[model samples]
Target: MSGMDPSAVPGPTVVDRRRLVFGVLPAAALLAAGCGRSNDDRSDGGRSARPPLALVYNGPQGCPACPETVAALLRGAPRPYRVEYVGGETPLTAAALADARLYVQPGGGADLKGTWRHLEGSAGAIRNWVREGGGFLGLCFGAYLAGRNPGFDLLPGDTNGYIDSPGATVTDGRDTVVPVNWQGRPRHMYFQDGPAFFLDPGADATVLATYPNKTAAVVVAPYGKGRVGVSGPHPEADASWYADKDLSNPDGVHFDLAYELIEATAGRR
Candidate 1:
């Protein structure tokens, strides 16, 4: 948790339908069926008339960046990676999360709430998703979920509410700025503060990035043929998202890292 930037950062809030723009990567085209299933679900690269990927976001409704990101993945993925936003209705069945070859969780605090966390589903399914050749990624709160038992059990971190973090964002007032650590000073950071989650040593998580306070910024864990990755930061958000929330971040706001990671994940299948 050392060598992180010394400020706090945040995640995206709400996303309207119109804000999303869908486009296909013509070179790697496939049918909608394969676009939503993981590789394991398909017999022939998901081109054999089956789904390619199934995403279990299982969180509260009306997430702004959620739909847009899912739309982009379904439309832009080079390997027919179908993306679906599971409305947080019922808890995740052990079979549901296990059926896929890969799973992605964006950085919403509530995304890790309720039956989703503490692994309401079967612990075996959670372990199988990563231990038995399934792939997974967690962002912010999603990363927090990886640490808890019954959850994916990737990074052993704790989630905390905001206190003394330095970052900027708009809440109620125009031009209003909240504090959270971002890329760095004078670099501008946007944030929607969430709970503070720190990594636990026994978890054996492989971290990628973080706040200046040595927190679990980005972490990865390798289990069996399955893999677990997390971003204490939201590297997939855009500028409009931060402006709408009145926040500034320094890690280069426009990010394709999430997609790159997914690309590697999709390759496994």
Candidate 2:
């Protein structure tokens, strides 16, 4: 909140879906039968299968850089990790969520209105899945979706009062760099139109990072047996992103931040 500037950047509007592209295939095929049952039902004693990380990639409503984001996540993860890409006609079913350990919603649409409108069918399934023990990581638009909304409602009361605080896409969509105090260090993160979550009286989330304004840039909480986390900026941005914007990050700090996010939310599984 403090270091963030209200400067206008250039990019697609929150509802703009014209430039959408679907380029990546799922890293692993989703098993239809093992929906929400025991995750370790395939080993010697019918041990549960290793849980894979599920990522939402709705083309039209998804961020253009989502593929790169996923790639970075995969690179940062330990070997033998399994990741899956959902959406783009692939349904996010209850069985799929139950079989997995974590679910990720990348940044895209400005508001949950359009996101929920299209993926409304998976809403209940996701909520139930997380409540049952699945982990969740939401970035940018994904963060807003977790808040008080008709969508997934994974974080219902958490966003009660700050409905309007940077909820929509920044006035300008241009890529820019902003300073964020993550954990404790001042790190640079890619900024677009991202939210600064305002927790309500009964909100259950814990603020992890914030802009200079003290606006929440990252927050995490437990939902039933699972965990839910959200970020208002793109820590997943790679070197190409910085190059494109003429920004410099020789230390690859953003990737470290991204790796930490995965470890914090999905790594446990």
Candidate 3:
């Protein structure tokens, strides 16, 4: 949030209240509690007594409710963790990153350029933080931002629309579900304008899931001392999201994939 222009920031919305109701406390509270100031402030050598923090990027760039959706998923993670929204008033900073173990970028609208405009200012801080052993998780549009072309450049290569990839089923950006081989098991997950990764030759990347076309749909890769896990679809999406689009996941609303990605990114897996 530091490098962003104050005037460009969007004010708090009703969704902010929704986030609070979902138990995702604000990042400011943690920062105020000496979570980021210094290692001496914490009894566990910089680790706060509070649950580990997972910072979700909530801003104009992300789709409405997507950040809250991701926060809700984190709340239900197998491990105890606290969720916080970062953007607008609480700009992402080095101190904020210090207290957080994982950072997430959720889905957004089709405005890739606009999304980049809002997040480009904090790119350096995010990159540096991940290089210093912080975790990063990108979902949908967030996955696009993790690539080399108009992104955080956290991935070894770039990403492209899944619709454009070979053997793709969904050719349009409509609210729908697509088939994927998740860890060798066939499953259907929500999809919109998700991306497919094109890793550079010799890049050490793990493919957790693959699109029907066999392209990487969910991937995990190392970035310096840290790690990055990304998904092309919305594994964190809930029943309400499907209800809005008159869609449903045959496998039901499961957060296992999301939780696994979080753990992997956080180096817990």
lDDT to native, each model: 0.45, 0.56, 0.70
Ranking by TM-score: 3, 2, 1
lDDT (Cα, tens digit) per residue for candidate 3, span 132-249? 8899998877887887546799998878878777778876545578889989899888776578888999999898999987899999999888999988887876666566556779
TM-score, candidate number 3? 0.80
Question: Per-residue CA lDDT of candidate 2, range 8-107, in tens?
Answer: 1212122211111121212111101000011221222333655355554544453444643554465335532455667665677886666677788776
Clashes of 3: 2
Alpha-carbon TM-score of each model against the true structure: 0.59, 0.71, 0.80
Query: Which model, 1 or 2, shows the larger TM-score?
Result: 2
Worst 10 residues of 3 by lDDT: 30-39
Clashing pairs in 3: 1-91, 1-92
lDDT of 2 at 48: 67
| Location of the lowest summed lDDT over 10 successive residues in candidate 1 | 28-37
Model 1 alpha-carbon drift over 4 Å, by segment? 1-51, 59-74, 77-80, 87-91, 111-119, 156-190, 194-204, 248-252, 263-269
- Evaluate residue 190 in candidate 1 and report its C-alpha lDDT on the 0 to 100 scale: 33
Against the true structure, candidate 2 reaches a TM-score of 0.71
